[model samples]
Target chain A: MATELIKTRKLAVGYGPRGKVLQGIDFTIERGDFLGVMGPNGSGKTTLLKTLLGLLKPLSGTIETHAGGGGRPLFGYVPQRESLDTHYPLTALEVALMGRFGRIGMLRGPKKADYQLAHACLKQTGMDARANKPYRALSGGQKQRVLIARALASEPEILLLDEPTNGMDVSSEKAIMELLSELQKEKQTTVVFVTHLLHTIERYAHRVALITSDGSLIVGEKSKMLAPDVMARAYKEK
Target chain B: MIELIQVPFMRHILLAGVFVAAGLAPLSVYVVLRRIVFVGAAVAEVASAAVALAVLFQLAPFPIALALTVTSFLALSRLADSQRLPLESLIGMLYAGGAAASVLLITKAPRGEANILNILFGNILTVPATLLWAMAGVFGALLVFQYVAAKELLISAYDPDMGRTLGIPVRAWNMIFYGAMGVAVAIAIRAVGALLTFTMLVAPGASALCLTGRLNRAFLVALALGVVSAVGGVMLSYQFDLPTGSTIVGLLVVLFAISYGIGQLRSAA
Candidate 1:
């Protein structure tokens, strides 16, 4: 019985009033829960993630995020890799160091301790050797790993990733899944991974939230949710 | 080159050039990263318009120009944050409007046409000591601000979505960066001229980014390129009797091309 980290009750997320893209998103994530959110294109998976991260206002309902010892439940968000422009002159270490910016606060920069933590995070992701490499030079898998490392550097109680394995090769996808599994169990950190990969949701996720085209959400244990009938019901709506 | 430095006016002009370039170079990295290079042009136009109006009405120029420039920057930053229109479209509209207003304002001033040419194509050779000191102060302040706020600014510009998730106050950082750019552009237009200020705000950073894959090194390289371009351009212009501002701009373009070529070659290798 782990502590409840995030609990959403009838959550409605959208761009503005009257523009609700997702509603009735009732779910509870406990400490160390690896939850996978599965949905088709335009199924509001991203909207839900954004809402949970507090990046977007919840159109309706309530979201309760239990605070940790630091007085807030810090969240590390790994946005879709496609969303970032890699052509900019930044190194892997530089990207990882971004995690420390919040804790480092204003007027002061990343000091020695911050850099050490960033390096340690990179090591956790097995990206320490390539830390000096330009971000653009890394392979897609490597880039994702670096991004996850960035998220880890923040020492969040919960990590949220959007489409983390999209476009990755089978080996890369498996590697990412394994790394995420190890991270969750080792750190007791809750993870909300958003993707459309059915096999990954069935295999890696402890719990699954399936969103339908009609804004319906079904959440259950992975084994029950991935049962043929439930998946069909989740995807069949138009 | 050394002979030119012997002249007091030339010395003041060169120092002014260095200050303007150094102040604006580091900022240009964010300008390029955020894809707001055109916003620099629009802000310069607004500064120019303010300057022409101040001169025409016998009001103080720098204060008026700086005020209007900063206000316009804030407005543009807000518009950009809203995501209503594409940033390019907003910047383009502002550029055209500011350009037209600047032309109209300059035409109505006492000694109108001459003032227009001077504002559009400034005389760095005649930089006043007071103006040089002003540039030094502004440049120093910008350097110090960047030193303290570089990481936060970098995080905000690199991936604002990530910044927002971390509760990094992305909007506030955007405002601060734009505010600094406004001051830099306004101060630069006095010596670098309205037309050349955009180049100073973009070229050095672009060139340095082309040459380096690290942000810290890029900043250092940008500052060096800016100083070199200013010093080298002034000497070349003096030696060839070329227009100082345009000469410096041409030199920066050449440096950018060279850097691009080198960067491409390195990537290929």
Candidate 2:
């Protein structure tokens, strides 16, 4: 039996007053659920993710988290690899270590345990060999993997990703999906996978949410959501 | 070389240079990462405006300048997240407004233009002992704050979105970072003038970044570069009777150009 981790009730999210992109969003994510969020450009997929992560305020309604003593959940976010400036002077290990900052707290440096945990995260991501390599030096797939490791290093119960496979080749995308699948299977980590790729969602995601341009959603199991009619309905809702 | 330090005025200038270099150089690393290089200039402009205002009104310059710079920094920090207005426009607007305010205020005060010019182009040699002590005390506190909060500051700067998700109070941290910057700008303006203070905030860190891809090492290198430029520029100015602030700024510019050239070659090779 899966425990409910997060729920949204009649939710509305966007920028400020004039920037309402999505509204009336209602979804329940169980612990260890692989939620694939699909939407076209400007379809408010990222806005939904941001709202769920509590990075952006919902215009209305509510998103309740049950992760910590039935309070706000600690989230690990894997933003688009492109979101980071590659030119930044950081190593993969250093990047991974950043995840621990939340746990380690401020007013002090990282302890020995933090470094060990960061290395373990890097190793899990198959990046321990290149841990010392500068972040900018990594390939697209390697960067994505390191970013995932960074997120995992936080030891979050729920992980949210935005376009994790945006500019990758076929194998890289496949590798990332497989990694996510393994994490879900082994750790029962709740994952929110946001992307535009339909086939990947159909293959790896247990559930899929297709957001229409008009801020509506069609959500269900991948088999149901990825059907031809359902997909076409989602696409033609502009 | 020995004679330069023998004079009390020159000794005060060197100490002031040390304080500015030690304080601003380490802080510049974040400035480079945050890509708010010109925020220093904007803050300096506000400081200059405040100084002119103080002079015109017969009020205290340091306190007024610091207060105005800190206020501007707070405004900038709040505007940093606004999607409606680009940050550059706001900074540019502040820069223009401050410069114009300084000119306007100067026009109404006796011997104001000359005094304003002096504020704009600082005379490091004339730094008072009291101001030197003040620089040391304020900058020392700032350095400690930065040291204790280095990791948090780094995460907040490099990826603020991630910082927020990780429960880092990014806005508060940003305010702290900018507050330190305002204080640095306020202090350095008296020693190196507005233009050189801006240059110090940007150039050393930029040059260090070009030379290395390691963060801690980059910091040390930047600090070293800042000290070298500060001490070297002052010595050169003393020897050649050139403007001290401009000379230091010139050295930093030269170092940046050289580092960039070397970086390009390294990448190409």
Candidate 3:
């Protein structure tokens, strides 16, 4: 039986009490699920992602995240690339080392084992060659790879990415998706990503959750969710 | 310069300068990286206002300044996270308010203008032995905190959302960061005046960041440049009959220009 990592029922997510963006979101994210959240520009896809990660509060429902040993499940979150400031003079290795910071705990530094893991993750993401390079000096695709390496270094059970391929070229986007696909297949890492592109959901996601214009959600298998009638109705493009 | 160091007052000034630079320079790396330079400026301004308030109430300046600066730092940090207003706008309001309050509070104190000038431009020569010792203790603690919490602090500043997801109390860390910044600014303001303290907190970090691509190296280079600027400024001020605070700031600016040039050349190469 598939293990449920996150389950939300009758959830409403938004900025504040009156700022409801999405409502009645009921979904289950199982282990090893490649779930893609799709919607229009203002349809609250990112908001829902934030809600699931517990970064934002849900207006009226409960979000239960189940972990093996109880408590909140460990999440690896990759924020939008543009949201991060590049002015910081951190090397790529240093950026990846941040993933181990929580495990390293407070008032302590990263151990030798931590460095080895960070380096291994970077090498896994094909960013080992650029490990010593300044992060700001990297290309967009390379930076995204480094970010993925950072997330992977956390050894998270669930990986969440917000618009992971927002500004990438077709090849870079494909490469990143392929990498995520490989991780999911090999490690059974639960992956949830937010995107507005229907093609992305069709090509990559095993399951799809669509947010309509009126703040309602439709979630199902990718094959069913991508049906022409459902897509047309969800996007109000009929 | 040797003759100058022979004077007891000169020794006191140099020691005070070294302590202040050593503490503030390393913290400056975070301030610059986090892009909160104005927080340093506004905190220093508020600390000056606190000093003025101390003078008016016949209270000890250090404790009063520390209290006000830390409180103001925490408040500003909280407000900066709010989406209602731009962080820069809020910092500007605090800066203006603090500057106005300092001017108003000083007007009623005896030797008000001189005291105001001293607060604005520091009387390094007049620093007492007690204050020097206090600076050593305070700055020493700050250095140790920075060393131990280096990774946590960096993660908190660089990717707060990621930190939160990882169960790091980012808000609490932010509070600690601002509190440490408050303590540093308060003490440095007492030693070097508000303007010079602000300069020390920004210029060295900016220069070192320009010179080095690595964060650790930047911290070391910033510390070196800070000490050089402080020591050079003090000696030049004594030899040239210049204002010590202004001289330090001027030297730092010159060093920054040199560093920038070197960085640009290296990058071109």
The true-versus-predicted C-alpha distance at residue B224 of model 2, in Å, is: 0.4
Each candidate's number of clashing pairs is 0, 0, 0
Q: What is the TM-score of chain B in candidate 3?
A: 0.94
Better of 1 and 2 by TM-score: 2
Report residue A169 deviation for candidate 1 (angstroms): 0.5
Q: State the lDDT of candidate 3 residue by residue for A100-186, as single tens digits.
A: 988987888999999999999999889999999999999888888899899988999999999999889999999988989998999
**Comparing candidate 1 with candidate 3, which one achieves the higher lDDT?**
3
What is the fraction of true interface contacts found in candidate 1?
Answer: 0.81
Tens digit of lDDT per residue, candidate 1, span A1-238?
A: 3288888999999888777888888888888889999988778899999888888889999998776763447899999998998757888999998988888877787889999999999999989999999888899999999999999988888999999999999999999999999999888778999998888887899999999777868898988988888778767856
Candidate 2, residues A53-150: lDDT per residue as tens digits? 98899899998778755577778899998889876799999999999999996687999999999999999889999999999999999999999999
Task: Return the top candidate by DockQ.
Answer: 3
Q: Which stretches of candidate 2 lie over 4 Å from their true place?
A: none
Off by over 4 Å in 3: none
lDDT of 2 by residue, B30-105 (tens): 8888778888877777777887899899998889998999889888988888879988899999999998998888
Question: Where does candidate 3 clash, by residue pair?
Answer: none
